[model samples]
Target: MDPIAPESADEVFLTAEEYEAVHAAVRTVAGSRGAGQPQTLNSLFEQWDELVHEVEEGYGWSAPELSNDLGCRTALAHVWRLLPPRVRAIRQPELDEIDRRFHATTVGWPGRDDQEGQWWLRRVPRHLEAETSQRSTHGWPMGWDVMAFPKPEAVEIAD
Candidate 1:
């Protein structure tokens, strides 16, 4: 089936060059400093912010017309999948802090059972959940893979 046919409204096809350009820019952001120590959560968070800009530039230069809704999702999934190994790694202490913040956020968050909560939950990274056996009883929602770097405000509150 052809991807760009009028009947395939939900599909957006990228040229091989476009796909490579977009993903390469994202990978560069993920590995800018080379690999060694695992990237800190805070550093990864900063890099993710930078990556957003890079993705925009990549799409702007490579395939502006193909940058539709589905294309955006594709780009995000690609970014998540291509995240550097160093960036995906998290240590025990940071994992503990993530658990603490997750629990704290649930308490008093009016939208805990609503879309906002779902959005927050969607960002929870697979590595974070994989480490769950080391701390708490629950794991992140199944199939989650993106890094959900915690908001500092959520963890700063005393419970």
Candidate 2:
């Protein structure tokens, strides 16, 4: 596919050199300070301000365009978003159901096999924590992986 002419209308129209130049420049100047995080143009730092100008003139693109679109600007903007006052939330309503089933079954079999013997087949709800830590890496936003378990007793018996 020719970068000078996008393969499809949905793609951004630019020359190959233009695309590579902008992306390369973004990577080059986005994190020059060695601060462990990408430097964002939104910051009021004098050096970053100067760097912004250099990027615009260097890439023939404006600062706002840099922020509004993908490329290194979008990545840096993502970093900025993640570096704010945001609390990560975890959904754990299933924990309550797990407790209920565990208690109900164990208590019902109190004298049978028995709760006193510490031996009872338990078939209750279990779920994994689905929480995402509010931290960005490589200018990417934070994310999470979820794992859910079905209630054992609720399993359908095969006919």
Best by TM-score: 1
Candidate 2, superposed: residue stretches over 4 Å from native: 1-47, 55-75, 86-159
lDDT of each: 0.33, 0.30
Candidate 2 C-alpha lDDT tens digits along 1-159:
213221345554444555454444334556543466444332312343343334333322222332332233234433333331211011122223333443443222212443332221321112211123232332111221111222233221111
With candidate 1 superimposed using the best TM-score fit, by how many Å does residue 134's alpha carbon deviate from the native? Answer: 44
| Residues 1-159 of candidate 1: C-alpha lDDT, one tens digit per residue | 212112334554556654454446455444433366333223443443443434333312211222231233333334545544433232233433433443333323233452432233322111111212232122122222121332323212111
User: What is the lDDT for 85 in model 2?
Assistant: 22
Q: Candidate 1 — which pairs collide? A: none
Question: What's model 2's lDDT at 30?
Answer: 62
